[model samples]
Target chain A: MANKHYAMVIDLNTCVGCNACMAACAMENQTPVWKNSWRTYVHDLEIDPGTDHQVRRRFFPRLCNHCDNPPCMSVCPTGATHKLDNGIVLVDDELCMGCRACSMACPYDARFDVSYNDVEQGKEFYGELHHRTRPGVDKCSFCAHRVMKGLKPACVETCVGSARLFGDLNDPDDKVAKLVKTGVAKPLMAHLGTRPNVYYISEIERAR
Target chain B: MEGMFYSTQNVWTWWIAIYLFLGGLGAAAVVVSCLTNMYIKTHKELVLWGNISAFVMLSVGSLFLFVHLLDHLAVIHVLNPFGLLTKPDAWIMWGTQFIVWMMVFSMIYTLPYMLETPFWRDMPLVGTILGWFGWLGKLSLSFHKVVGWLAIINGVGTVLYTGLLLQSFPAVALWHNPGVPLLFIISAFSTAMAFLLLVLHLAIKREEDHDIKVLYERTDVILISIELLIIFVFFHFTTYGLESARHTADILWNDMGWIVGFIGFGLIVPFLIEFRGVTKGWNSATPVVLAAILVLCGGYLLRHYFMYAGSYERPYPAINSIHSQSNYNLLIE
Candidate 1:
């Protein structure tokens, strides 16, 4: 809702998910390579038996959709989870109670529990020092820190396919808006009440 | 068949469901026990003991609910208790509110008794009223959205959360189903009965009353019947549908012999002894203890299998399942 609302439109028709985007994101954000990164790829979906299992795998790279009406925010007993007008659901690092309630309410399984964790000394995690900072939640921030300085998402910038497109949807003339007007696109889980902002192109066999 | 939508519940869902069941069970049990205090001495002791369980249920229950609900919304927000009748989402919001109040009333009514204060014990009617009020409040949360509207608020929450709680992982297929709500409610009922029997035996023994021992023993037969039916449906129904679900059934049949020991030997044995006690017109704790332990084991194992078995990836039969899909673009955060 600021200068422009950002949204992602995935072109499933042209995507050759080479894991380049994931690595770029981790490097740019200094995120650890552990399971709880800001982004993840839920690939290897084998829907049917064919020539072999290798060919059946379908990649589904994911990050938070930064939905318009997120359920995760409403169920927080404390004011720890906050959704900005710009469509970002933020977990205030300081106020989280380490309660796993929001994780359950999330239909998308977006909330990750950083709990029961112990810090190990001298462990170089993703080129950064690994240390437990207490238990809480973590997920993609849509690169807010980078967005403040005026730049595209690190993944979009480094993408080889130009398959991932991001732009202001509020503007009719914007790139994302133009793509939306013309291309066949889909969202991951459309049935759940949460109105996800991310869009996809081409027919996707999503888990209804 | 096309893939349908579903969820994989994890630890968070479990926390919420357990909280709801404990509160609902504790509240409902107290209401029954407290209300019948005048007619039966066993009921009086039950009313007194229900206080501790009520506290345990309410305290731990609300903790998990709040943890999930708070983060789902941002900042400071409170449910418009009035909108519960209008909006579907309002159901959960309101159900949670009702549970909290019931917790409050029960705690307030029982504190003096817990502390052995003459004030609360002297006014038994007030205590009874509190228990009734708590029961109504807790019961409201259990209403399904059909009559209640939108989604299953408290009851379905208590039930399906158990399923989703187990289903979130791929290991347990039995717990993962659209049929989860029904299964959970049945299991919860059976488990509650198992606990009730144990508690009732104690309450009755304390009163030195043998008249109702036969009734308690009869109830065990009913509980056993219900539990077996539940288990049968859970295994047989799922086994016939999906192949992956069948594997889960196999896991239960093959490796869950300990489950029989727990449910049959432990629970059934006590139930039988209690039955014998009734026929002889005597009181016995041995049967009650055995049944309680067995029922508890059954409940825990039921959930455990679902969690572990749900994680197994099943091979789906399909033509050209190995078709190399073209790499597609995805939304970057």
Candidate 2:
């Protein structure tokens, strides 16, 4: 368990822009749905708009990268945002002072503040059994709770076309490891030096 | 496509800006007053008011910081000694430590002076409380220079912490500049001088301390000059440097508050007024007071605009380029 390293591989070729992951994440994490925020979401990118060339739309899914060198963790005053042994970054609600310094430091726009009002509304919107009990900065935890139970993240579990893949990167036999080893799957903004665990397989390679 | 993916950071707002301004102002005031007392002349009134103002400003700024927190009670976690020990690189943790120590040291430094003042010594309940701390005041007076030096060091720390807090956020292109701390330090001192000038002219009405007043005006002129130059460097660096920084410059350039309020009214006018006063003989209090007010306003505006102009780099530009070019090639193929 100490050697375990979790990672995700997202294939743009297989994703259908169905947004099943967003819904699954909202239902699972009880995010501020009324505010249109999510732990994971898909962006419909239009390439070469208003040009002579044919315009094309691609679905780009995004989430917290859970970087090895998380800037959010370094900037957090309360030591609330921390990395687990398995490489998943998580926030301790009781420790977070809600300063949003993590949100300011994150390059991927991964974090959002959960205010007192959001928590009060959440009790009604998500019922009393909601996992979020206190207000703090919130982000995708790679569904660490479920992952600890030997289950995939909600978004990966409910992906419409099986485009999302999650596995331990430390295991050479895992599909995520192979995809990363082959260089077919690449992390976004690699030059930023965050060393993100989430990798993306480009749609252009799929078309080729 | 250039501006399509750019996002302005919205987490921090005016509250954080106010906290930064007040914290810097307070710390700078303490530094100036302490140095003046040690080197030039020992003015008890100056020391007393300076320490009191610093304590009050820092307290009010901390109040704003508390208001900005989403979970107010969770702020206690920031005081965990373990977190402070472990997170040495965290500017916020260092800032909290600096601020707390500064408040404590400033209060102790002010105690001896407070006990000496008849207004405080004769007060009913407060006088009794002051009497309780009279022994502590004697102890502080015995080691007055040590307490003053400690307060000065922490004051400098608090001032630098204000800028370091923003500089630690590498994601915000506007705040990530090396010039940020320099600019903030210079502005903090200049505004501190202006604050003292206002107090000297209006509150203390110390016309006899002409030498000290001249010293403040001279120091402020130099500080303001350096600050204006650093601002130029800031604009040049941000404009020609990173893409996100260039975008930040564009936003800041168009901001009237940054251009007119901060540059025109805040820095330049005050500089000219002080420059003329320093060069010529004694002038009216009206212009001096007006210039001080402008400088203070300008200091707050600088922080406000810097906070609002924080822009994140566009998401994965290299990836987007590859995606578009590769897609176009595939369509052609």
Candidate 3:
């Protein structure tokens, strides 16, 4: 709990939008494709038209913010959605009642309903086995399975452009910490005060 | 519309709307019943009817909500009473605790009267139990008086909790407003009155009092007017509050459910009908019943539209460039 805030930083400058990270995340997490399990996906954004009349589509990767004060966790009736001491918010599938309260509470639209059929179909379609047998809320886990084992998240490890970086933000020696200290990275929707752990190193005013 | 479902976009649907409506109605009914029983001691039969109807309504509403849970098998997780003390922030947890206590207290409050009924008097086991506790009847009556206040408090909590449950969803702009609970409680109280009026008119015609009926009609009219005002404030606040809130307001403004169903039919028409009781007089049970029916229908529509009008803010719209510059300019910064 002391100085152990794990975070992810995405450098939009270097991101090529190849989607290798998205595929890697899906495979590693055994997420379903039917419902568009966009735990990590590259979004194409069209910049506002300038005075010179030019429109450029920028590649923006999106996922759960893993907030310090997650609304989803606060609204959960059964304590099914919780945030770990290491700063990773996760869902307890067995405890979840599938009330969809967390889904509505998430400002990031990060949570998705995991039906029994969805999980079963996911196993067949992706040919990936999952340890979670029950239906509940599903979302990005920040690769907690691997992170706890000292391995980088599949998305961070497989990024072709080296855009994604995972490290302890509380550690000053960490590159993500330096980047954040230098104001090269910032969390999304800061105005809403969720205090997201996922930061994007971009200077775009619109994203702010 | 057939293709439409509540879970389609992760937005709530009909089940939740109906649940909110029923929950509020049931809670308000209980509170009203308890209040009547506490103050109007002479109408024992009427109070008894109210208590029975309130219990039935609350239980049925709770069951419907439970049935609507997605992971129905895991409902025990919510039912575990320990979570009430543990999960203080969870409004749903608070709601569950309130509901359970309300039911328990309501039953205890009604027990003495229930046993006094002819059916229970004839049963040998019930008679024997009554005989055994006959000496303690005075103590039970005092306990009932104290428990009646507790039930009323819980009843209000149950009604308000339903609104707070929805309002706790910070992501949904329409539901996140402070006015939601106010609107819901007002509608709940009005609907409760309508229900009482209907039952008194149809079921207890002999013992029905004219002054109480007139008071309820007047109170209902005022409630409807306040409801309309709060709804307007809700829309106005959201329309100007945030972009996300504006989106929900836009939905409510355009949708027929809000315009025709909730506003025109639910509030205005009913307000006009109930207004007649104040300006003129009710004169007959027909107008009172008709007005009551309209209010009830309107109350349901209010909740249904409230839920349907809720829409999430578009999540993290991808911004490609900013500051009147291209991505190349961003790199320099």
**Winning model by TM-score:** 2
Query: lDDT of all the models against the reference?
Result: 0.52, 0.84, 0.76
Backbone clashes in model 2, listed as residue pairs: none
**lDDT: which candidate is best?**
2
| lDDT for each residue of candidate 2 in B1-333, tens digit (9 for 90 to 100) | 252355565446788888999999999999888888878898888888888898899999999988888899988876665667878778989888888888888778889889989988998998899999989999988898898889899899989999988888777678876789999999999999999998888888877888888889899899999999999998898788787777678778877889999999999999999998899945578888888999999999999989877766644321210013332232223
DockQ of all predictions against the true structure, Cα-based:
0.09, 0.42, 0.45
lDDT of 2 by residue, A18-45 (tens): 9999999999989997876778878877
For candidate 2, report its TM-score: 0.92
Candidate 1 vs 3: which has more lDDT: 3
Q: What lDDT does candidate 2 reach at residue B150?
A: 90
What is the interface root-mean-square deviation of candidate 2?
Answer: 5.9
* CA displacement after TM-score superposition, residue A138 of candidate 3 (Å): 1.4
Q: Once superposed on the true structure, which residue ranges of model 2 sit more than 4 Å away at CA?
A: B1-4, B123-125, B316-333
Q: Candidates 1 and 2: which is better by DockQ?
A: 2
Best by DockQ: 3
**TM-score ranking, best first:** 2, 3, 1
The TM-score obtained by model 3 is 0.87
CA shift of B11, model 2, Å: 3.4
Ranking the candidates on DockQ from highest down gives 3, 2, 1
Model 1 per-residue lDDT at B301:
51
